[model samples]
Target chain A: MATLTLENVTKRFADGDDEIVAVDDVSIEIDDGEFLVLVGPSGCGKSTTLRMVAGLETISEGAIAIDDEIINDVPAQRRDIAMVFQSYALYPHMTVRENMRFGLEESTDLDTETMDGSVERTAELLEIEELLDRKPGELSGGQQQRVALGRAIVRDPSVFLMDEPLSNLDAKLRAGMRMELQRLQNDLDVTTVYVTHDQTEAMTMGDRIAILDGGKLQQVATPLECYHRPRNLFVAGFIGEPSMNFFDATLEGDELVLEGTELSYPLSAPIREELEGETELVLGVRPEDVKILDEATDDHAFPVTVDVVEPMGNENNLLATFEGSELSINAIVDGMRHVQADERYAARLPESAIHLFDRSSGRALHNRRIDDEEKLLETRV
Target chain B: MTAAERTESGSSEGRLATTLETIDSQRAALYAVLLGLIAFYLSPLWGGLTTAFKTQTGFVQTTPLAPPTPEWFTLEPWELAFATMQGGLVNSLLFVVPATILSALLGSLAAYGLTKLSWRGQIGILVLFLAGVFLPYQSVLVPLRQFWSAVDLAGLLAFAPFLAERADLIELTVTHTAYGIPICTILFRSYYKTLDDEMIEAAKIDGASAFGIYKRIILPLSMPMFAVTLIYQFTQVWNDLLFALVLVTSRSNYVVTQSLNELQGSMAQEYNIQMAGAFIAALPTILIYVVFGRQFAKGITGAS
Candidate 1:
């Protein structure tokens, strides 16, 4: 096992006339036995950074070290890391057994008995023993992915780097393989750095996700931290499903006046103290955080014109317009609500669940109160 | 109006029938044209085969399309052709087999080197091979002959195998082999260009070295193209008359085409035996093509 670290790594490619920085001064520390995920959208430098770590691409500036040893000049074969590509990159002509045995036979000085045992163990671990004689072209996509992973596992490398290994599988198979990978990573405890553009996969698989955008690191935190306390608007807008709702509002004392409707919210003590004469702020709320107020109850609620209501079985996602801006509010509503289009509904926001961001900078106004140990424990689940 | 409409409807029906009959006649005419083209292309081979069996007197008397009588069908021409054409048959085999094999091996090696290897002079080397495609063999005859003579006069005869025993068919065959490589290499290289790069990359990741990949993966995959190159080179080498005449000075070293030319020279009036000898000379190439036709098609199509 080894701890892989990237110190101020950068990659640049020529774009027409200008040099486009694909990865910009990115540093990430992957601990032993940690499933660290590098997650971002396409053109966000996540894959480029992963390729750099795998030694497939050269770093323009900075050092990459595994276990504190600089591997700038080390070839991929000598780096003691095995990678699973997005395409699987299985030798199309070779059988599963031969594909798995290739790396071991090439890299190791193992005898025939040990090599055979390792191949058998990897095949059994992947539950592909019956498929050992079959070529990759004959196998299904999921089976090919398993063989790809088996190829990596049989090597018993210092680190396992995967670039969207499950992206090609179907939804059901992807989920199954995700769980299988988690179990395998837990069992093997190798330092694995997975790169993916899927936020859901990042939230479900990563021990700590390093989010990137436009070649810059945006936020590196546990999934919950990234969701609950985003460092910037990009992270906030990127992490969650239906995404976090944002509205331009003025902080009139403790009340936010949006589209001529005023809703009172008790700000966190630190934010309240910091809001000295600051007239503008962005109000952020998750879909699940908004509560639907009863008709008769007079709470700190604002009226929104419900334009479209999406019934998601258990919860209703209401796409409503608040003060001329489109906002989607998700609330747990019972069975079928007789809410018509263009009808005004009152939705209440719990002050504790409200997130405040600076209007111009889009940075979180309040810091999280949870300790690192608690956050770590929460993420381990 | 009803009485007038009945005559018009009957005329319309007759017009429709005429149009249908005209369409059917045109379709038959189209088929006839297609058959005529096919028969026109095949007429020469048909005539040649029939002429090979006919006696000289009957061949002159009979019309080209007429069937031979039993009396006119004689084995005398076949026997004379085989007995007199022995030197040419041996010469063709001596030149064609080794020349074809050598050209294929060297050409594939050149192609493999150009495709797989990284060298500074690769483009120059490829262009050098491609230059052979445009080069006229006749233009280089004098220089090549002078070069061969100079080597012989300098007592470097043993150093140059092709000229070591000038009278021997085998030694002269090597000269043709060397001359045939340039086109073969170009053909093989063009075929190799269609192969998928992913296969090569996968083999590399599988820990195959350059040579190992060529031997285990590329050679097997390129067999079809190799067969095409062999057949083309074989036919050319087997049918070559100019190179045989220039290089082989003796009757013992004469190739099939050279021997046929000599047979025609000696027996100018014996048209029957000449046709039989021509048929004999053409058989090997035709048989080789028929045997390897599938591979030749696969090579051109690049199925693998």
Candidate 2:
């Protein structure tokens, strides 16, 4: 219902004489009815950003606005934002109905009949109508989770801020709730800012994911776009499972040769032209893109010894070290393929599938090709 | 070696006996010891009850521990004690009720504010309240008496002129309530500290103000602590002999303890009347224990 914007928002905490900058200057604009996920590792300021948005923590600098109205000075109660905590902080003394009715009773002057009606409707929506009389202490964990969700939805707030709300549930329940929550958000059309450290949740739940690290925003893009064409080396390495493999190489003419190793990857015309004057660079490739072949048919393929193999039911992940080098790269192949350890295999890090980044800056200079490598490059040029 | 060896071997033999004994025998021995201790502690109460039933002549003829025969038994001591102590009992009730409820209420609010609400220097204030618990009441008696004397509420409290007439009882109530708060706050603060922080945050986001949260969430959660503090303050104020002695000047202002003191005969000891008065004075405290103990256990489960 509302578009949330953070303009250069920062949070600093006074720790004795030293100041700990919990959230540095970061700006993000989420469209109306959009689901934006803040994702990062532990202590990456993702939760801090969500708390600032929730008005639980104050913004040290810059402003946060809703629908073009700056609300930096608005208290949490007046903000009209409902939040689901990771712990599902339901009042133990109150029954499910009272818990759901609390926000409506406090924030709005709704009559008892109307409040109870809304609570019952929400309980029916969550399929928790039978639990109306039971206190939170009597409910099971998943039940408590639904009650927490019901508590927020009963208020019908414009924006929903969830702080890792699904993390406490077991894996199977978490997956079910994840899909259910996304569907509910789509149906309700509420602007939601969800904070989570789980990459899979970020990738699947959000329309666009904002990746943060060390109190700074790294990238904010669609999950597929972040996976396919990451703006920086951090995003390229962070987005995918078994992540991207990187080799420190120097650009020598058309070839990117691994420093102090004989392993060299010859670039194609377009990439070579792109790297014409560049010297220090890192060649990055995704694990799934590292192809395993029976024979070294081309110059791009190398005879590598498989160090280890991990069978993952549908695919096999092989850690292979290049020939005449100590470099080990993870190569994921089909489960039907028979790969073994301590055996030499022809593995290819194809030129078109490789991404190049500036060695020192950790910025992505060139991304891998899509269906049309030349055409994608043409648009960029 | 003989003394040392005797003790060492005896202890070793006992340890062997303990380990070799079956669980049932050990339980029987524990029950025997506990029953013996119970009897040892309850003998004085038995003596007092028996003495209270004795006639005036039975005091001279029989031992203090002996029960009077049915023909000699009489309820005259109990009747006499009740008649003399009724005014004092009413005076005690006037102060004890307000003091007990006010101290517990104020302390719970203080506890919630100190533990749940964030502010600078809270720990320092908590430590100071903790220090108040250890302060000796004897050291403050002179100052407390002088403070009450200096306080004049003649026209200022015209709304409650009865408070001036019953100023002695009112003074006791105020003194007991103030003195009772620090320990009560310490007790309730520890209980409040165990509450989850997210519970408060959730309440805040639920649009409840700080005072509203305390009313709805904290006050209900602290029912068990209130029961504990109320019973404790009730007993302390009711049994207090020193404060009543210093504060009560007229015979009409006498508390139960002072009235019991007056029951001690001027020339001759009235054991029957004294024991009956003591038993009468103890009933309220015992009744409070019975009522609040059940409430205390049911308010919140101590474990979870």
Candidate 2 is graded, for docking, as medium
Candidate 2 deviant stretches above 4 angstroms: A259-261, A272-278, A323-326, A372-381, B1-36, B39-76, B120-124, B154-161, B295-304
lDDT of 1 by residue, B1-304 (tens): 2343345445655555566676786665555555556566666666666677888887888754455689888767778888888877976786688889988888887898898656789999888888877888798778767766665532446688555544445545566677778888888888778766545544454445677667766787678988798889888888887766676666656778877875575535676687788888899999999998999998888774
Error of 1 at B104 (Å): 5.4
lDDT of 1 by residue, A1-381 (tens): 999999999999988999999999998888898999899899999988987877667789999999999998875557888888888878666788888887777677899899989999999999999999999889999999999999989889889988899999999999999999999999999999999999999989988889999999999888887877789888888998878777667876666765344445445456677655565787777776766653415444666677787777765777765534454555545546555667777777666667777788777775334446465546553
lDDT by residue (B196-282, candidate 2, tens digit) is 888888888999999999999989877887888888889998999898898887688899999988899999888998899999999
TM values, all candidates: 0.79, 0.89
Which residue pairs overlap in candidate 2's backbone? none
Model 1, B149: alpha-carbon shift in Å? Answer: 6.0
Candidate 2 chain A minimal-lDDT segment of 10 residues: A372-381
CAPRI grade of model 1: incorrect
Fnat per candidate, as a fraction, reads 0.13, 0.76
